[model samples]
Target chain A: MKKLYGVPGGEVLELDYPAVADYLVQFLRRELAWRGFEKGLVAVSGGVDSATTLALAARALGPENVRALALPHAESSPESLADARLAAEAFGVPFEVIDITEMVEGYARLRPDMTPHRKGNVKARARMIVLFDLSVAYHALPLGTGNKTERLFGYFTWHGDDAPPINPLGDLYKTQVWGLAGELGVPEKIVQKPPTADLIPGQTDEEDLGLSYARADVILEHYLKGYPDRYVEGLGFSPAEIRRVKELVNKTHYKRHLPTVAVLSSTAINEFYLRPLDFRIELE
Target chain B: MVRHAIVQLAPEKGQIRRNLARLEAALAELAEDRPQVVVLPEAFPTGYFLQGGVRELALTAGELEEALTALYRRVWEGPLDLVIGFYEKDEREGAYYNAAAYFELGGRGLVHLHRKVFLPTYGVFDEERYLSRGGTVAAFDTRFGRAAILICEDFWHSITSTIAALDGAEVIYVPSASPARGFFGPRPANVERWRELAKSVAAEHGLYVVLASLVGSEAGKGMSGGSLVASPEGRLLAEAPVFEEAALVLDLDLDRLPPVRYDNPMLADLKSGLPLLLNDLKRVVEAL
Candidate 1:
């Protein structure tokens, strides 16, 4: 029930990072207590979001209970691995770095005409494979590193950075990520470095989206806050930018719900399936 | 093409050591086909338990690592990988986490670990009270194909599935330990959920989804064990029985599936007036 950041364009609310962290830990522990999971696996991207997760996970679960996986593509910055190692050391968790460039390139070669989007997806998925493999090795839950800001903007690769047993930071905004990093004592270097996917050379997340985080957050705030489209348009945004944001919101909207199913029968499966599985009534 | 098994076993309370022995026997049966991989249910060692004093039921980090390594090494003759779920404590951080650990046949010594992501706060789940949520999505490489995992709730969540598929997982394995509810009884709601989730996610992303669930009852909850495999187009390839423990084997031709986004083109076409339509729909529906 706790949130790390305020809704965009809404009144800003103060968040207790440690309290939030404790809440998250308790949530996982209780969930695992029910699910019966004790070990946890974290995939470290050498980024602020993942670093904060590692620290939180270490605090909630002992460092010995946690294992860190570092997955790198050949195109990944060299410092990426080093930063992930630094995070692992800080948490005193076991760490391993698996290079996935070869596998990704092999797939690209098979589909020689693959687009940049497809190639980017390959890199993302390859990293996921490494994480699951490690999860298997350590018998731990695979941690998800995606934050709310990225999910809101549709900035992540499907299935790759997205899959995990639990996502500790799904609700946090990018800025709140900074706040948590400071509160958790994450390295300032990772916190300050330009946020890039490192998917390709000289490519950053903002450049790919053709907008800054500041503007995107503002636009997202307006949209999520129920501001009229015209009112948001009146904020001196470009026609193309407005269109892009609107398009992203619409296209990725499906990402927000359980897939919709059309109903024709009197006792429709949709009505029955609307509830989460665990919430369903007893059979017989 | 590869042969894989989704093993649904009965997990009992306070029987980590014994439950693992039963799993060892299941592996023995699955190994006959010389399987490339075997996917087990979530928290196979100890059945799902949310009541008080459950933390003591979790295994120590060292015991978990040693036991899993030995199991994978002993059961598998050829190249094999096992994705198993268990409970472990982080000694330094002084916290508990719900984790899935991987045992690669070789001495990889813990290839990856994922802390559970989407902890369900409502219903029979009170995960918020016990475990810490994981923050990173993870994938792995294997001889069969690229793989990744989503423990239980992560499979139900959208972004988690999207990230795994987008990350290049030819096959994504979901190790689940969902309880059976009476309303959706006879048919496991979790199985249907996994079926729907796999269909939507795989069709949208173009990948195979393998869901392995724990069968039988543990403590007060009955697990909805219906291990199933779905193709990228959302086709049901194979599935195991529900309520009872069994291993569901499936063969996937990763090469035959069409590219999810490129070939289908629905996601790509959303750049048009799709947003306006959806927003209007949301407004109309919510207003009423």
Candidate 2:
């Protein structure tokens, strides 16, 4: 048999902007509305992912129906806080600010010796608490903003940044998000800014991952397409880059799934029962 | 000239009554000056992707007729034929099938029933786990012409469509609920792929093709809806917009059929060559 499948090299990361924009907009509007919530909310972290997500939601269900919430800790960059506001203002959505410093500090002081890594996790979860709490108060659907790159690398806090029911940018890689971020009317300064989680001071996502997104995204794409390591290396990527993406993806497999359930019966939720993810039964 | 319509719909998941009511409303909105044939997307009465829920939702032909007659009588007191995909229960076989049924409202209530032959069990699909594979591959007589139905995955395989063509099916209606996956192309890659498939199937067999697809999202998976109709020569008559609910109504000229088949003659040639094929198949079976 001839060679049937291989890496589609030309413009692999390129997207059909118009078609993609319509699909994303419709995705948010239709998914949220069917569940009886016309409103949507996104936790803007001053990153391209959240900004793109916010813009999509605004386009889907008018900006008035979408809320932009920025939860900032004391250690978070002031620039991040300002940029989050810029994103919210650019889209004309109401921006709500909450200082998570007091909440995270409550737990941090108990374990004063907790490393910056643990502190970062606490800050992320604290923001999630505010997000879900407001979801009920505002009657808005919580939309996840984590990009595919961050998700595959397991860079996000488990159930913290990835907890929302609907996500427009979850399928897009970080590199691809930049392309869409521009078309969605996001500010140039915000789109060009170095990506970060903004949980800790002086932190850059590239620095933390030990690889830039440009290098990581290509490696991840080729790797996921079942390209051999040798073939990926021929594409001008270093072995370390390929290994870094592969290891992180394998290590964080559990983060991509729901909690493991021990199947004791034939009918277990998400195990043997196997209901469609969106399956709903209208009750009397 | 037959007024054929593909009503692109986004059904509420697992809501049989609501979906049927929605379909009824869509049909009522169409022009009633002429008799029309309408095709609804796969699983039109109930939403697709009902994993274990298929067993509970599957209805016998009698039960489906009972529900639709009550609901659809409000739309067309005149002649209005319908084609729709649904989950079917076979009481005699005690099996559940992903089936598509054709109805001639003015005449026979149920003309043909085609269960999906291919149950895609790979990647995002779990059809084999829930649906029994359909055994028959033949066409039936309709008020319009000899017609056949191919559910979503059934259309992907060429042999299934070939069998219908060989059985003298002059018109093929495909009701699908395919999800949008790829973004590298100018449209959803599936949209482009379906366009090519529609063209190829219509041109090869010299048959009129109508595709009705579902729109809307379920748990963030958007059912890509680009419902379309192609002429016997593979010319696109009409296409609905993607990711939104829209109706694609067009006039189909069955008179053009004689000229189209005369030009291609692929189906006639196929009929002439079928005996040789059966002989070869029998030899292979004997060797096995």
Best candidate according to lDDT = 2
Instruction: Candidate 1: list runs displaced more than 4 Å.
Output: A1-10, A230-243, A257-271, A277-284, B1-288
Q: Please give, for residues A1-284, the per-residue lDDT of candidate 1 as tens digits.
A: 88687655533423556545544554455445545567788888888888988888888778888888888888788988899999899879899878888899888888878987778788988888878887777778877878877888778876678777577777677776777788888888888888888777678878887887767666776777677768777886766776777777778866655467788776565453222222211123
Listed per prediction, chain B TM-scores read: 0.86, 0.94
Per-residue accuracy of model 2 over B1-288 as CA lDDT, tens digit each: 888888899888888888888988887787564537888898877788888988878889778877777777876787678899999999998899999998877678988899998888888788999889998888998877788899988889888889988887888999999899888766788988898899899988898889999987877778999999888898888988888899887888888888989998988888888777998878987999
Model 2 misplacement above 4 A: A1-11, B31-33, B274-288
C-alpha RMSD of candidate 1: 24.7
Which pairs of residues clash in candidate 2, taking residues 3 or more apart in a chain or in different chains? none
For candidate 1, what is the DockQ-based docking class? incorrect
DockQ of each: 0.01, 0.67
- Candidate 2, residues A110-140, lDDT tens digits: the string is 9969999889998888888999999999999
Q: lDDT, candidate 2, residue A52? A: 91
